[model samples]
Target: MAAYYSQNNPDPSPTSLTFAYPQTMDWNRELLRNEPGMLAEEKLSDVERLKVKIRMFARFIGMKGAETPRWEYERGVEILARRIERRVRLEEETEMRRKVFMGPRAWQA
Candidate 1:
Protein backbone atom coordinates (compact mmCIF):
# COMPACT_ATOMS: atom_id res chain seq x y z
CA MET A 1 0.00 0.00 0.00
CA ALA A 2 2.91 2.31 -0.50
CA ALA A 3 0.93 3.92 -3.28
CA TYR A 4 -1.87 4.78 -0.90
CA TYR A 5 0.59 6.26 1.57
CA SER A 6 2.44 8.15 -1.13
CA GLN A 7 -0.74 9.69 -2.47
CA ASN A 8 -2.59 10.04 0.84
CA ASN A 9 0.40 11.35 2.80
CA PRO A 10 0.41 14.66 0.94
CA ASP A 11 -2.03 15.74 3.60
CA PRO A 12 -1.15 14.59 7.13
CA SER A 13 -4.68 14.20 8.48
CA PRO A 14 -7.20 11.42 7.82
CA THR A 15 -9.77 13.97 6.68
CA SER A 16 -7.34 14.85 3.93
CA LEU A 17 -8.67 11.90 1.92
CA THR A 18 -11.01 13.74 -0.41
CA PHE A 19 -12.08 10.47 -2.01
CA ALA A 20 -14.88 10.05 0.49
CA TYR A 21 -16.52 13.37 -0.19
CA PRO A 22 -19.27 14.36 -2.59
CA GLN A 23 -18.96 13.59 -6.32
CA THR A 24 -17.36 10.34 -5.18
CA MET A 25 -20.59 9.29 -3.46
CA ASP A 26 -22.14 8.20 -6.71
CA TRP A 27 -25.49 6.61 -5.84
CA ASN A 28 -26.35 5.41 -9.31
CA ARG A 29 -23.39 3.05 -9.35
CA GLU A 30 -24.22 -0.60 -8.81
CA LEU A 31 -23.75 -2.19 -5.37
CA LEU A 32 -20.75 -4.31 -6.36
CA ARG A 33 -18.97 -1.33 -7.89
CA ASN A 34 -18.67 0.67 -4.68
CA GLU A 35 -16.41 0.30 -1.68
CA PRO A 36 -17.67 -2.39 0.67
CA GLY A 37 -19.15 -1.40 3.96
CA MET A 38 -17.37 -1.60 7.31
CA LEU A 39 -20.36 -3.24 8.90
CA ALA A 40 -22.78 -5.45 6.96
CA GLU A 41 -25.16 -2.60 6.08
CA GLU A 42 -22.88 0.35 6.71
CA LYS A 43 -22.47 1.26 3.06
CA LEU A 44 -26.21 1.50 2.52
CA SER A 45 -26.58 3.47 5.76
CA ASP A 46 -23.93 5.99 4.71
CA VAL A 47 -25.50 6.50 1.31
CA GLU A 48 -28.86 7.34 2.85
CA ARG A 49 -27.31 9.66 5.39
CA LEU A 50 -25.31 11.40 2.69
CA LYS A 51 -28.41 11.90 0.56
CA VAL A 52 -30.21 13.48 3.50
CA LYS A 53 -27.26 15.73 4.24
CA ILE A 54 -26.97 16.85 0.62
CA ARG A 55 -30.65 17.64 0.38
CA MET A 56 -30.63 19.47 3.70
CA PHE A 57 -27.51 21.40 2.80
CA ALA A 58 -29.09 22.47 -0.45
CA ARG A 59 -32.10 23.77 1.42
CA PHE A 60 -29.95 25.45 4.08
CA ILE A 61 -27.95 27.19 1.38
CA GLY A 62 -31.18 28.28 -0.28
CA MET A 63 -30.32 26.16 -3.27
CA LYS A 64 -33.87 24.90 -2.74
CA GLY A 65 -36.71 26.37 -0.76
CA ALA A 66 -40.06 25.36 0.69
CA GLU A 67 -43.03 27.50 1.55
CA THR A 68 -42.94 26.60 5.21
CA PRO A 69 -41.33 29.14 7.57
CA ARG A 70 -40.96 26.62 10.43
CA TRP A 71 -38.18 24.66 8.75
CA GLU A 72 -35.28 27.00 9.44
CA TYR A 73 -31.72 26.96 8.06
CA GLU A 74 -30.08 26.29 11.44
CA ARG A 75 -32.20 23.20 11.89
CA GLY A 76 -31.08 21.85 8.56
CA VAL A 77 -27.45 22.60 9.42
CA GLU A 78 -27.78 20.65 12.67
CA ILE A 79 -29.08 17.58 10.83
CA LEU A 80 -26.17 17.69 8.41
CA ALA A 81 -23.65 17.96 11.24
CA ARG A 82 -25.16 14.98 13.06
CA ARG A 83 -25.10 12.80 9.93
CA ILE A 84 -21.44 13.67 9.30
CA GLU A 85 -20.50 12.78 12.86
CA ARG A 86 -22.27 9.42 12.63
CA ARG A 87 -20.63 8.55 9.32
CA VAL A 88 -17.16 9.43 10.62
CA ARG A 89 -17.60 7.40 13.78
CA LEU A 90 -18.68 4.32 11.84
CA GLU A 91 -15.82 4.71 9.38
CA GLU A 92 -13.25 4.98 12.15
CA GLU A 93 -14.58 1.86 13.80
CA THR A 94 -14.34 0.00 10.51
CA GLU A 95 -10.77 1.17 9.99
CA MET A 96 -9.77 -0.02 13.43
CA ARG A 97 -11.16 -3.49 12.72
CA ARG A 98 -9.41 -3.67 9.38
CA LYS A 99 -6.09 -2.71 10.92
CA VAL A 100 -6.56 -5.31 13.63
CA PHE A 101 -7.48 -8.08 11.23
CA MET A 102 -4.60 -7.35 8.89
CA GLY A 103 -2.15 -6.52 11.67
CA PRO A 104 1.17 -5.22 10.30
CA ARG A 105 0.34 -6.70 6.91
CA ALA A 106 -2.30 -4.02 6.49
CA TRP A 107 0.37 -1.54 5.47
CA GLN A 108 1.95 -3.96 3.03
CA ALA A 109 -1.34 -4.85 1.44
Candidate 2:
Protein backbone atom coordinates (compact mmCIF):
# COMPACT_ATOMS: atom_id res chain seq x y z
CA MET A 1 0.00 0.00 0.00
CA ALA A 2 2.88 2.44 0.84
CA ALA A 3 4.71 1.73 -2.44
CA TYR A 4 1.52 2.11 -4.47
CA TYR A 5 0.54 5.40 -2.70
CA SER A 6 4.03 6.99 -3.12
CA GLN A 7 4.14 5.98 -6.82
CA ASN A 8 0.71 7.55 -7.45
CA ASN A 9 1.54 10.78 -5.50
CA PRO A 10 4.88 12.00 -6.80
CA ASP A 11 4.68 15.65 -5.67
CA PRO A 12 5.20 16.27 -1.93
CA SER A 13 4.63 20.06 -1.97
CA PRO A 14 1.66 21.50 -0.04
CA THR A 15 -1.45 22.95 -1.73
CA SER A 16 -1.59 26.68 -2.43
CA LEU A 17 -2.90 28.90 0.35
CA THR A 18 -5.59 31.54 -0.17
CA PHE A 19 -5.95 34.77 1.78
CA ALA A 20 -9.31 36.50 2.19
CA TYR A 21 -9.41 40.27 2.54
CA PRO A 22 -12.22 42.25 4.10
CA GLN A 23 -14.77 43.99 1.91
CA THR A 24 -14.38 47.30 3.72
CA MET A 25 -11.38 49.07 5.28
CA ASP A 26 -13.24 50.49 8.29
CA TRP A 27 -11.82 47.93 10.70
CA ASN A 28 -10.01 50.46 12.94
CA ARG A 29 -13.18 52.51 13.39
CA GLU A 30 -15.16 49.36 14.13
CA LEU A 31 -12.54 48.16 16.63
CA LEU A 32 -12.62 51.40 18.63
CA ARG A 33 -16.43 51.45 18.66
CA ASN A 34 -16.79 47.82 19.76
CA GLU A 35 -13.84 47.43 22.19
CA PRO A 36 -15.43 45.82 25.29
CA GLY A 37 -12.78 46.92 27.79
CA MET A 38 -13.16 50.55 26.78
CA LEU A 39 -16.94 50.49 26.92
CA ALA A 40 -18.71 52.31 29.77
CA GLU A 41 -20.70 50.29 32.32
CA GLU A 42 -23.96 51.67 30.89
CA LYS A 43 -22.95 50.68 27.34
CA LEU A 44 -22.49 47.03 28.25
CA SER A 45 -25.22 44.57 27.21
CA ASP A 46 -27.76 43.35 29.80
CA VAL A 47 -26.07 39.95 29.99
CA GLU A 48 -22.63 41.46 30.60
CA ARG A 49 -24.00 43.76 33.33
CA LEU A 50 -25.79 40.82 34.91
CA LYS A 51 -22.61 38.73 34.84
CA VAL A 52 -20.69 41.39 36.77
CA LYS A 53 -23.47 41.63 39.36
CA ILE A 54 -23.62 37.83 39.61
CA ARG A 55 -19.85 37.66 40.18
CA MET A 56 -20.14 40.03 43.14
CA PHE A 57 -23.12 38.10 44.49
CA ALA A 58 -21.27 34.78 44.14
CA ARG A 59 -18.20 36.16 45.92
CA PHE A 60 -20.37 37.49 48.74
CA ILE A 61 -22.07 34.09 49.13
CA GLY A 62 -18.73 32.30 49.11
CA MET A 63 -17.40 34.54 51.85
CA LYS A 64 -20.64 34.18 53.83
CA GLY A 65 -20.53 30.38 54.22
CA ALA A 66 -22.39 28.99 57.27
CA GLU A 67 -21.05 31.07 60.19
CA THR A 68 -20.12 34.38 58.47
CA PRO A 69 -22.03 37.54 59.47
CA ARG A 70 -23.91 39.88 57.11
CA TRP A 71 -21.41 42.72 57.66
CA GLU A 72 -18.50 40.46 56.71
CA TYR A 73 -20.24 39.34 53.52
CA GLU A 74 -21.01 42.96 52.56
CA ARG A 75 -17.42 43.98 53.25
CA GLY A 76 -16.14 41.08 51.14
CA VAL A 77 -18.35 42.17 48.24
CA GLU A 78 -17.13 45.77 48.55
CA ILE A 79 -13.49 44.62 48.50
CA LEU A 80 -14.14 42.45 45.46
CA ALA A 81 -15.86 45.37 43.70
CA ARG A 82 -12.90 47.66 44.37
CA ARG A 83 -10.47 45.05 43.03
CA ILE A 84 -12.54 44.59 39.87
CA GLU A 85 -12.70 48.38 39.32
CA ARG A 86 -8.93 48.63 39.77
CA ARG A 87 -8.35 45.84 37.24
CA VAL A 88 -10.61 47.50 34.67
CA ARG A 89 -8.87 50.85 35.14
CA LEU A 90 -5.47 49.21 34.77
CA GLU A 91 -6.53 47.51 31.55
CA GLU A 92 -7.82 50.81 30.12
CA GLU A 93 -4.54 52.52 31.02
CA THR A 94 -2.53 49.73 29.44
CA GLU A 95 -4.56 49.93 26.24
CA MET A 96 -4.04 53.70 26.10
CA ARG A 97 -0.28 53.21 26.58
CA ARG A 98 -0.18 50.62 23.81
CA LYS A 99 -1.94 52.97 21.40
CA VAL A 100 0.41 55.83 22.31
CA PHE A 101 3.53 53.71 21.80
CA MET A 102 2.43 51.80 18.72
CA GLY A 103 0.53 54.63 16.96
CA PRO A 104 -2.56 54.36 14.78
CA ARG A 105 -0.72 52.86 11.80
CA ALA A 106 0.28 49.77 13.80
CA TRP A 107 -3.12 48.11 13.21
CA GLN A 108 -3.02 48.50 9.45
CA ALA A 109 -2.53 45.49 7.21
Candidate 3:
Protein backbone atom coordinates (compact mmCIF):
# COMPACT_ATOMS: atom_id res chain seq x y z
CA MET A 1 0.00 0.00 0.00
CA ALA A 2 1.15 3.57 -0.67
CA ALA A 3 0.47 4.59 2.96
CA TYR A 4 2.49 1.59 4.29
CA TYR A 5 5.51 2.38 2.07
CA SER A 6 5.42 6.05 3.04
CA GLN A 7 5.27 5.26 6.79
CA ASN A 8 7.89 2.40 6.86
CA ASN A 9 10.16 3.09 3.87
CA PRO A 10 10.83 6.46 2.33
CA ASP A 11 12.34 6.63 -1.27
CA PRO A 12 11.96 2.75 -1.76
CA SER A 13 15.63 2.36 -2.70
CA PRO A 14 17.74 -0.53 -1.27
CA THR A 15 19.45 0.48 2.01
CA SER A 16 21.17 -1.21 4.96
CA LEU A 17 19.11 -1.71 8.13
CA THR A 18 20.56 -1.10 11.62
CA PHE A 19 19.59 -3.30 14.57
CA ALA A 20 18.68 -1.85 18.01
CA TYR A 21 20.76 -4.47 19.84
CA PRO A 22 23.99 -5.47 18.05
CA GLN A 23 25.49 -8.90 18.98
CA THR A 24 29.14 -8.29 18.06
CA MET A 25 30.68 -9.42 21.38
CA ASP A 26 29.76 -11.64 24.32
CA TRP A 27 28.05 -9.82 27.25
CA ASN A 28 29.37 -12.25 29.93
CA ARG A 29 33.05 -11.87 28.96
CA GLU A 30 33.45 -8.78 31.13
CA LEU A 31 31.47 -10.35 33.99
CA LEU A 32 33.57 -13.55 33.96
CA ARG A 33 36.86 -11.64 33.90
CA ASN A 34 38.77 -11.92 37.21
CA GLU A 35 40.98 -9.14 38.56
CA PRO A 36 43.10 -10.10 41.54
CA GLY A 37 42.90 -7.79 44.57
CA MET A 38 43.50 -8.21 48.33
CA LEU A 39 42.23 -11.80 48.34
CA ALA A 40 44.40 -14.33 50.29
CA GLU A 41 46.24 -16.71 47.96
CA GLU A 42 47.23 -19.16 50.71
CA LYS A 43 44.73 -21.16 52.73
CA LEU A 44 43.99 -20.08 56.32
CA SER A 45 45.86 -21.69 59.24
CA ASP A 46 44.23 -24.66 61.04
CA VAL A 47 43.24 -22.51 64.04
CA GLU A 48 41.86 -19.72 61.83
CA ARG A 49 39.96 -22.20 59.64
CA LEU A 50 38.49 -24.01 62.65
CA LYS A 51 37.49 -20.71 64.24
CA VAL A 52 35.67 -19.68 61.06
CA LYS A 53 33.81 -23.02 60.90
CA ILE A 54 32.85 -22.83 64.58
CA ARG A 55 31.63 -19.23 64.21
CA MET A 56 29.54 -20.18 61.17
CA PHE A 57 28.06 -23.14 63.06
CA ALA A 58 27.25 -20.91 66.03
CA ARG A 59 25.53 -18.39 63.78
CA PHE A 60 23.52 -21.17 62.09
CA ILE A 61 22.41 -22.53 65.47
CA GLY A 62 21.58 -18.96 66.70
CA MET A 63 23.78 -19.43 69.78
CA LYS A 64 23.78 -16.50 72.21
CA GLY A 65 27.40 -17.44 73.07
CA ALA A 66 28.45 -15.91 69.75
CA GLU A 67 26.78 -12.55 70.55
CA THR A 68 27.76 -12.35 74.23
CA PRO A 69 30.30 -14.39 76.16
CA ARG A 70 29.56 -15.66 79.71
CA TRP A 71 33.14 -14.87 80.68
CA GLU A 72 34.89 -11.58 79.89
CA TYR A 73 38.16 -13.35 78.90
CA GLU A 74 39.95 -11.84 75.91
CA ARG A 75 40.35 -13.80 72.56
CA GLY A 76 37.50 -16.23 73.33
CA VAL A 77 39.56 -18.84 75.18
CA GLU A 78 36.49 -20.96 75.96
CA ILE A 79 35.37 -21.17 72.33
CA LEU A 80 38.93 -21.89 71.21
CA ALA A 81 39.18 -24.68 73.83
CA ARG A 82 35.97 -26.26 72.54
CA ARG A 83 37.26 -26.10 68.97
CA ILE A 84 40.52 -27.80 70.03
CA GLU A 85 38.63 -30.61 71.80
CA ARG A 86 36.49 -31.23 68.71
CA ARG A 87 39.57 -31.22 66.47
CA VAL A 88 41.33 -33.73 68.75
CA ARG A 89 38.32 -36.07 68.68
CA LEU A 90 38.17 -35.88 64.90
CA GLU A 91 41.90 -36.63 64.63
CA GLU A 92 41.54 -39.62 66.99
CA GLU A 93 38.63 -40.99 64.94
CA THR A 94 40.63 -40.57 61.74
CA GLU A 95 43.63 -42.38 63.24
CA MET A 96 41.41 -45.21 64.53
CA ARG A 97 39.88 -45.63 61.10
CA ARG A 98 43.33 -45.70 59.49
CA LYS A 99 44.53 -48.29 61.99
CA VAL A 100 41.43 -50.45 61.60
CA PHE A 101 41.62 -50.33 57.83
CA MET A 102 45.31 -51.27 57.88
CA GLY A 103 44.70 -54.29 60.22
CA PRO A 104 47.32 -56.06 62.40
CA ARG A 105 50.21 -54.88 60.17
CA ALA A 106 49.55 -51.28 61.39
CA TRP A 107 49.87 -52.42 65.02
CA GLN A 108 53.28 -53.99 64.23
CA ALA A 109 54.48 -50.74 62.60
Candidate 3 residue lDDT tens string, 17-97 = 322222233312321222354123222334654555565467656787665333324334644565567779989999998
- Model 2 compared with the native: what TM-score? 0.33
Candidates arranged by lDDT, highest first: 1, 2, 3
lDDT of 1 by residue, 13-79 (tens): 5544445333343434432222544333323346554554566556555675523334334444555
State which candidate, 1 or 2, has the greater lDDT. 1
What is the Cα-based TM-score of model 3? Answer: 0.28
| Model 2 alpha-carbon miss at residue 66, Å | 7.7
Quantify all predictions' global Cα lDDT against the true fold. 0.51, 0.48, 0.48
| lDDT (tens digit, per residue) of candidate 2 on 1-109 | 3333343345675223211221243323321133556534323344544444555455545645335346545544655575588789999999998778575577683
Indicate whether candidate 2 or candidate 3 has the larger TM-score. 2
Model 2 CA deviation exceeding 4 Å by range: 1-66, 102-109
Candidate 3, position 61, lDDT: 65
My TM-score estimates for the predictions, one after another, are: 0.31, 0.33, 0.28
For residue 57, give model 1's deviation from the true position in Å: 20
TM-score, predicted candidate 1 vs. hidden true structure? 0.31
